[model samples]
Target: MSYVPYSVYQPLTKNEVTLLRKKQFEKWEHYFLNPIQIGQKHTEFTEVRDVILQSWNRSKEYQDLNPMIEGSVKNISDEELKEIRKKNEVFHLAEPVLKQAGQELSDENHVLLFCDSDGIIIDNYGNHSVSRNIGNSVNANNGAQWSERWAGTNAIGTSIILKQPIQIFSSEHFSYNCHEWVCSSAPILDPLTNELLGVINLSTTANSFHYLSMMKTIGLVNQIERILFHNYYQVREMMQNIYIEAISKWKNQIVILCNSKGKILKINNDTQINEITSLMSVTVENNECTTKKEWEDEVTLHGSQYRAIHKKIFWYDRFIGFISILEKKSRLSHSTTIHNHFAKYSFQSLIGNSEEFKRTIHLAQVAASSDSNVLITGDSGTGKELVANAIHQASNRFDHPFIALNCAAIPKDLLPSELFGYVAGAFTGANPKGSIGKFELANKGTLFLDELGDMPLELQVQLLRVIQEQEIIRIGDKIRTPIDVRVIAATNKNLVEEIQMGKFRKDLYYRLNVIQIELPSLRRRSEDIPLLAEYFVQKLSVKKHHGPHHITAEAMGILKNYSWPGNIRELENVVEYAVNFSANGIITPESLPMHFHNQQTLPINSVSINPVKQAELDWIIQALKRSQMNVTDAAKELKMSRSTLYRKLKKMGYDMKSLK
Candidate 1:
């Protein structure tokens, strides 16, 4: 089954649906309460899951009334404990996946529980603060035996027994102590064999039932299984490749070849290779091939037993024929052959001379010089991403990958796998061989996390942890892979305001804001408009294969004076539009978008761009209002003495007091 993302679960789940469900829960509760008076025969609760009914029956059979919060467990010998742990080694793969998921539901007063195949909790945590409040009823701490017999029909125990995913809420939990909590659980299984391994359970307060709880738990279970499957496939592929390479190297010496099924597919140089019909036949017809020197075997065919060495592989845990290693041997390995992604922009490419713009670029360069996390903030089209690319290109990590992902573009459920990656069989619908995540791809380089304010708070916690530890655990994999990635996060939204609104995490904000670079909006740096537009025009000419073009003074005035709400990005689009509309290499007012001439929101219904004259003229008018015609106070407000303000205005041919 596919996962139900929060978008569908949280919003579409209405108050009416919850109220309807509460009514149904009351029906099941009534039936369970009147067990002695009610007959089991022909008695059924409509809309109630059979599994839940079975759990209730099991609890009734055991005469377990008012079951305690914590279940009793028999002490095992060290050897037994070790064997149990070893058998449950696969359970560790679910730790990170569950940890991230638990934190996702932390605000909902939830906790995550992981149990071995026997339903004994090996690990448990979530919102520890909420967990503490639930007291003994909730805290199913490590080593708690929660099998159906011990825990008495709980989600974890019931899941293990049923070998399927299940959800139990409040009074539905067969035990009285667990009535305050809602638990949704999915069984973890062997990726290759689908054998029941354990269960991944999410426990939350019944009063605070989250709509996505069951869906998320099931999704996580699928993810963990996919990881196991992925890892197993990788191992088989790796061994097959190694075996094929070894045999090919000794092809001339032993003149032998075999296919994946151990049958002699081909042979060379009249060597008696066909005598070994199959790997197992070789082992059977000859002496038992032990003391396993890889690819070496004693085989007998045609009644002649000879010591033959050919690559042999394994399937499951059984030794089998050599699997095909079809890939050609290459001089370049993954590390060297892997493509190094390039950043499109460098500091020199940031075309702006405005003081505010220049200061931002300089700060970006400084941020690049040091390997600190950077937060680039500005309006959507104000070149925050370009600044990020420039910083990456300028940094020591330039030679490595410059991975970029827009947080807003990816779905919330898929973000975890895309960021950290997963092992094969980590979940259903996952690749059989697994896939690499951005964190791994950006190792030793820079990862540009754009639209970071849009990142869900659940993921922010994990992101903060990765930043602090400089490490990540793949989904359904226990190994902690270290990464040296410089994070450059960009956002159009104000992160400080987001943190105040509780949409962003304070700790993560501080971590990512180590080197903050706030780019100026295009409106704030109006003088740079011409320079930026000209650059875009020139750049677009070559791309569009249009002739070199010059914008007329009238068109430039419109471009400069009209306030650019969409910033540099919008300006670039406008330039492209103008180039296509322009003819004879000259762009006039006719080439500008219709809105410029529409004058609906134009400042003063006229378009004029004169940097020095316009600035002095505006100041003369503004200073007059602030000073009420007093030149001295106006000069002070301008941070200049009275004579300097008057002289500066007069140099540009402005009569300051008379104009005021």
Candidate 2:
């Protein structure tokens, strides 16, 4: 008897090999049946391949497998098998490759089997009759459990135990049920984790065995792994891009990119690296962070609060890693604090009768009927916030909180905490008692985000996520608090231009702009100026403890003719100033603002000039005032190039130096 290496297939003919395997089987049976002589008798089986002999010993001794069994004892239901295949996402990736291999081997009476790491056949493809025969004889069909413990020494089961490729021929199989089959199987492993993902096996009748079968199995395994690795790297590259984009967009904040395992890959320069890592470790340990595609929560590290926004990166259906943005939670000072959480106005409070203003009010009334987000766009002081409040007051959730936050007023570093809130002791300067974020406070109600265009790009990403998920996580807290907030974001700047300039996220813009209500500027709705001025005069006179005041026809004409650059807000201020100066409780042109008095002689209402030119002159004058007579600054305020502003000023017969 001579020992043969299993690695190199012996060149013996079918008949000779059959006889040799028969002899090995007889020896195996004799050794297993006579347990008392097993140790000594195993040495006598030198003609058998050492690998096969070892498997036989494990099957009979360790597994206590009965070689006389007709087929594999363990099997799963069809539904269970389907779930296993579904859960092993890599199996789907290997299916096409395996089907191709099956096609190539169709004429060879071979069936290709894809099994999970547990050796349960998930799928099989090949000659239908051959597969039927194997299934009937050895129960090697889909869902059959082929682990060594269940199916004895066989290719699929033994390859799993060895974590390598193996060839099991007739009679070499420890179970009598598999004696007529030959199988070549190799394990497929995850490239990153190196964990056995599954096994690929080629099985056929022993009489049809070919030396190239094991080679083909190994090749298919290699090919499948290549696809897996390619997908893995592609996902890695995508996640890297996300990380880089996040770092670039959030340069001032702490950004950490991590693998699915929560290991950090890239992180911006920050002094809180260890604290962040520790926080991540806790999240992973508790199994709290990996499930969702996008989630946010607060974490406390070293007594300081941080908001950890987790955005899972995926390539198609496979999760690769995630980007974790850590924004520090800081308490806003008293001046910027938001105290009111109730709508102060209703549809009736919005006083205007011009068609343009009426149209805006109409749209807001429609917006109030639904829970959709609203974006109120207009120039400064166009009553965008007033419309937002009216919408909230008119909605069904009117009884709930109407929290408002002006994004531009709050410091960038403190905005997240203001919007999302922080836990007690979330940061060094944070209030020890912690405060509720606007999102949480406005739960089941409306959140008016004023100056939405001024929201930082990084905060915009979180805001979009919150809108989509309808949830918020307070700073320094791992638990996510669900919210039902109808957001009404108001912006004075054109978000479309801001988006093109990369200062605003287009997705966030769309999220907020689901129901856009663009209010007409005061200049466009000049017809409403007299009515607005009269309304403000009466309201201010009561506050001043005086008799109801009247804007004289002269003053009313001046108000309607002037372009109200600050819109309704400016009109209210003018009326308030007039009320203070009116000796007879009559708001006359003489009591108007000094600038308005100076521009009184300008042909602002001259019938010869078009209303467009009159409005342009008013805008220029207003910008100059706002910019404190600096032509360059006024040009920026007017959103025109300096040279363009100079040309317009010169054409309008205005001396730039005199204005300065």
Candidate 3:
């Protein structure tokens, strides 16, 4: 009786204990009923919690001097209540979180409840027969509003009155009916509106009462608020980022827009830029301007000062955010936008330190610095387009458009028109005005022609001419327009073989193959298997509803030994599938796809390794083992440089550095 609920395990002092006993007697006597003495009784019980005491007072008034109350009112019906549940999203949104929280508590019989703002228990999870404890006769369905005037001095009703979290332990219930139960309840308020929406609760038998239950319930309510906040902003943030990216190229000044909620909606760039941070504003805007205004004074950024502008952006005649443009505010924009036209991937995204991969990246880097036509060759799923994206982003043309066209994906006849724009009346389906071809669209950018080997011979001649002449002519219009585009072509088939077979033009192949980058198969870089698998797991985990995931060591070993015929793309898909099926936060062989169980065996002849290749593998394996399988350290141990070691690894199919 002397203990304050959820007080972090502190013992009450002698004076507090003495005070509690006197208050408890007065409160009990008041609830026990003596109408004329009730007011005097409540005034003397100074130790009682204001919320709890107030709730009891309201309950007594509602009971109309009745000393005992047995049940809750069932005003809402099964059907009508079901409709209410459908109307409320909090009931559904809190279900998964409730389930997780209920499971986290060690007590199997603990129950979690979600109630509407009116205190109607809408959803209950955890421990079977959760409603039976409160008596099944009370329409123990989505029924019963625990208002102070209804259910009296209990967790839910008192919490509603206090507008804060509270706990009611055994024998504390004003209703003689629920005295056997102990419950913790926290009010869930709308973060945006700050209005009471509902209450989340944890309940169990008297003996199972937990002091931290109130804390846990409060934590869950906070979490639900955060999830709601993020859910509303996720799409808005993505849109803001897209807009920022589009304006980054043109806006060399500072422009920021924040929402009504004071959250950063979007900005041209990050915080005050590096160069702009050094300068103090010469003149600050003191007068509040309700409308758009031109900056009369300037602020210095990077040793230069420029004018600033202020504008308010509104939607539907309501203020949403601000758009402030600062000129000569040295530094960069806060947009944090990845320009759509720019490459989506780069060397940083390649994700492999294997020698073969490094050499390929090196070649791609060298080719990126030039304006030459580059050819990237690899089997399907070997990340050909990845290399192209990397080169495009690193090249001087990175800020410009990076248009990709799949020669094989497009219809053969349409390929010509698609590559070289068609004019009005050029063909039946051609646009009336005119169409700009990929060549024109990528005039100052890079044109990624995927599956170039699959291009028809006739079209190849025109493509070859475009590359040679730096110009293109529309099908209907005979006017030749000059183009200055960088071409990066990718092929899965052997171009040389296609030329010999007369399916591909030899001259076009030569023209497109100015600098070649050949990607290695996954099987050839077997040591990179674990690395890729872990990366895929972490990347794919974000898409899961559960927490972070991990793969068992045995599962990883099995993955590394298997031949990945479909290459890196296939590896990603396999990881995704395994993650989807994994259980208990860990992926085991049992969680893997059936194909993993049926790993194919290599033929005896193909399994044979030459002495040099064997030696290379042994040394690399030893070095990797010594460096804890780190490529950077292993390269240094072998007196090899980063890209140089990668090239060496590719030279002999795959080379291993020596640990010694």
Candidate 4:
């Protein structure tokens, strides 16, 4: 009587039962044929003579079926052996993601197979019955040689080979054994380039497989792609936003907006009235006057006291808005000095000229000149690392390596291994050889630790010891390594405050603060506006391989009066923006960004309101009209404190007496 393979189980699909039966038959055929080959080899070749001759009686059926095979058996050539090894190589790639997914698949009566590009099983998980039936280990340690050609064309190998998703079921499999298994596979793509990253598959015995399993795997792959896509986008966007905010926070008085239409849409704290009016006038011109849309130069309507520049903003596929640059009338001379100072540090490659920045760079250079540990404090996007790099390059150590690392970029658990070398076999799956940390790599050079505030306190202590002793002991080693290295640490957060909160070590703070450089926010420095614009315009033109470019005098003026919250980085960005958007030969107030336009709506078209100066004018005019041009009495009623009121009237360029 036929013996049951193992035990009774539930009924299975026709494909599933057929696959098991076919594989069983192939196994029986192999067993029955093996003894005959052994008998022939023993008769001619001496390698397995004793065992082969002993088993010859069991192979009578094989001898009757063949004639030439009865003489001798031949050895496989090196080339033939090489082909077997090559097939094994393809299965190794799927070992990791498969191992991680093993437990989950085993419980579900499912086997996850990592196949080579050829659909040969490289690895798998599940019970012996399933594993054997699936035929995963026949070729390698995985013991399976099932290929789409032998099993059937399927999602696992087909998707990876084609670099696209595919599905194949029992009937679709090329081989009867694979017909019992159903598979769903998708191409894992690199988030950035949309290239095939790898292939992911979910499979089960035909009896256990369901359509839902296929759907679930596809959903998982999609989620991974979405996550990768979002992360890439956020990284870029965060950098830009941080730059803008850093400048804006410091330059509180200037409001810079990038809006549609090459119009100045807003202004910051500027005292000049006539200049504000002219800028407002330009905004009106951009909106109402079509007039061929040619860019206009710096226009002096009321006076030559103020200047403005216009630049357009473009992102992705469309032109988003314009950036209106505004600046003050006074401080032009000192502004020129600041501008030149900025030029010295300013990159024809970078844009930004601000007083605060000039001082910050000067301090950074000084810090760099010495080996003293420096603490660079500033808001995000204020170019803390840029400043650090500048210091490194300016110092005597410029010839040596200047390595910068973000202390907070790595996870806390891995920070130790990342910062200090780890001995070989320190942990499972670790490099067989020791791995050197960044600190060791930066030996005899400058190590710029960015985002130092984010380092965990535990790692901080270890780092502090390294800095103090000028040595490090690798994980899993007793030997101490002494090295000479200079450290430059920068952070956007206030470490002093962090210290008070018990988050940072005071000792480490002192070590890092040996020389401290606090960068000023962009808004504080109003004097360096013009040179910055010119620098950005020229730099961007060169980078774009475009115009011999210019930002008109008016544009320069607008830049000065406006607040810059994003600092030098923002200034550089705006310049790059203007340079990039320039279709005309020059960057005019109209070509400028709309956010730079310091204009607003009014009830009447004729009523030109310079908000900063207009408020004062309105007050003065009302006081004069009420007092019948009596200055002494009008000052009292207006509560102007006399001299102050007189000064205000003079500044407003209005005579109450004339109104009377």
Full ranking by lDDT: 2, 1, 3, 4
Better candidate number, 3 or 4, judged by TM-score: 3
lDDT per residue as tens, model 1, 1-660 = 222211224533446445544664575567666554322543456444566666666766664443443533323455665666555546655667877877776666887777788887776677886666553644476666677776676788888877887777666666566766767888998877678988888877766777778887889888988877875665444454444444444332333344334455444334444443444454434433553424444444455444554434433223434422222123223334465466767887899888878888889889989999999998889988888889999999998989999999999999999999999999999998988899999999999999999999999999999999999999989999999999999999988899999999999999999999888777667779899988887665434322346799989988876557688899999998887888656799999888778754212213354787677667554544433456764665466787887786666565654453
Each model's lDDT comes to 0.70, 0.78, 0.69, 0.57
What TM-score fits each model? 0.43, 0.49, 0.56, 0.39
Which ten residues in a row are the worst by lDDT in model 2?
A: 331-340
On residues 364-402, what C-alpha lDDT tens digit does candidate 3 reach at each position? 899989989999998899999989988999999988889
Candidate 4 regions with alpha-carbon error over 4 angstroms? 1-358, 590-594, 597-660
The parts of candidate 3 lying over 4 Å away from their true place are 1-32, 36-43, 60-67, 79-117, 122-131, 136-142, 169-172, 179-182, 188-366, 381-394, 398-441, 456-465, 472-481, 499-507, 520-660
Better of 1 and 2 by lDDT: 2
Name the better of 1 and 4 by TM-score. 1
Q: What is the alpha-carbon lDDT for the whole of candidate 2?
A: 0.78
Mind giving the per-residue lDDT tens digits that candidate 4 earns over 300-416? 534554444444433321233444444444533444331111101211222345545766666776786788999988766666777776776677766566677887787888888
Model 2 C-alpha lDDT per residue in residues 1-660, reported as the tens digit of each score: 112235336466778767766776787666667663333434567666777767776776654458788667889999998888777767877888988988887877899999999999998888888899999999998999999889888898888988888888777787787878878899999888889999999888877777788888999999999998987775565566566667755545678877767788888854778877876666556654446567788888678787777776644344556677777677312223333466877898788787778888999999999999999998899888889989999999888888888999999999999999999989989998999898988988999999999998988899999999999888898989898999999988989999999999998988888999998767666667777887776555323323435678998877766656677888888889988887556678898888887663423332344679768987887666544466775675577898998887677767677565
